[model samples]
Target: MDALIATVKDNDLVVAFALVGLVMGVAILISKFLTRGKFQASAIAIILGLVLAYVGGVATGGEDGLADISLFSGIGLMGGGMLINLAIVATGFGASFDEMKKSGLGGIIALVLGVVLSFVIGAVIAWFFGYRDPIDLTTIGAGTATYIVGPVTGAALGAGSGVIALSVGAGLVKSVLTMVVTPFVAKYIGLNNPRSAIVFGGLLGTTSGVTAGLAATDKRLVPYGAMTSTFYTGLGLLMAPSVLFFAVKALVG
Candidate 1:
């Protein structure tokens, strides 16, 4: 047993990959058998991950969640910003300029509208919650664009940890909602083509949610949606900390 434990610990990253794969596999099965594919596997896996993280935190009283248990320590690195950014870049690699041209002006409009709407919504929510500071408002607003943007904006603007956490929560809620709701409304919203998928993804601007939602709606649309969503993330990262931050500060001041 000691030898096996040491072996597992030595190859913790491989174990973490296996663990994530297992969770995804199970989530896929649940999505197929239980939900009949109404809910996406990625969405289910996210919910399961959150539950496990909460449990791990409560049991260990540690900040790193499941990673604090040692056996799953590699999850910390595997889920870190480096790997996340790499995945985003990898997703972008699959995009084709020809396909992107099909989206054109509609895609650009969606991207701009998505960012502005999410920022306004997040800022309003932050204000309603008694956070009057520009940094807090901007951080949370950027989070509504995506969880990644939230932390990046907060760090760049020197926002508090609590505000960052709130921003992450707000983004998570938007992601989950996007994932859960897209399929139901896809047909009604005319989300039936590559151009529409691109626009939809740009509007939502949550890569995981947009990808998973589009997957549920139509697997063929995933690449198109993911492509624009990737650009949306990049644009958000560029605008949130600088342009949006300054705008909020000016308004608040």
Candidate 2:
């Protein structure tokens, strides 16, 4: 356990980034091929990530015994896993692609608003907690916020606490919040069109793709959902680190 923790501490950034890229690549490929293009890249990435983590743990002979894999870890590995599920469900039952195309601008506006809303919500919560220190709150808030908006927010929160616990916690919190809020917000704001469904479906498909592989299921719907989720998850991952960087800057400034 100690040795594994040391290794992780020593190579945290490298390992995390490598895992992120590798997982995203693998998930995308798997969904593209195995699911006959029904799945998403993000889903394949997550499953591959879990496999890598488990393999790494085994190779290192870590005494933690898969302690690296948890709900929080899942969030890091499969950022929008749950949201993919929601997106998939919404797509399955909501608007069609034609409708989405007609409301293209509206959809874009809604997505932007959703992300902004998430950030505001996160900042408000952090402030309410009396978290006055920019450095500390930025880290915590970023971690917590990423789930809502993606890694950008999570990274922001991660600055304060370098510990995996804080990072994973923030990620998990963000994921849960996004899963619960994004869809409702989108619907309420009238972004529930076919284009939105297709977008959401793709995201869900990505998550579903990897989930299907992990669960040993070969259903097309699984991949469909996974792919849908993967798209958004990847977007989140790309944005998370940057958001964290800027978050710190805002606090300092």
Q: lDDT for every model?
A: 0.85, 0.45
- TM-score of each candidate structure, all chains considered together: 0.75, 0.39
Best by lDDT: 1
What total of clashing residue pairs does each candidate reach? 0, 44
Residue 166 in candidate 2, Cα distance off native in Å: 4.0
Q: Lowest lDDT 10-mer window, candidate 1?
A: 87-96
Whole-structure CA lDDT of model 2: 0.45
- lDDT string, candidate 1, 1-253, tens digits: 9999998899988988999999999999999999998777876776677677777889899866788889888888887768866865565565677877977888889998899889989998889989899999999999999988999889998999999998888888888788777877888999988899989988999987887687667777777887778788788889998888889989995
Highest TM-score scorer: 1
Residue 21, candidate 1: alpha-carbon lDDT: 97
Query: Residue 201: error of model 2 in Å?
Result: 8.8
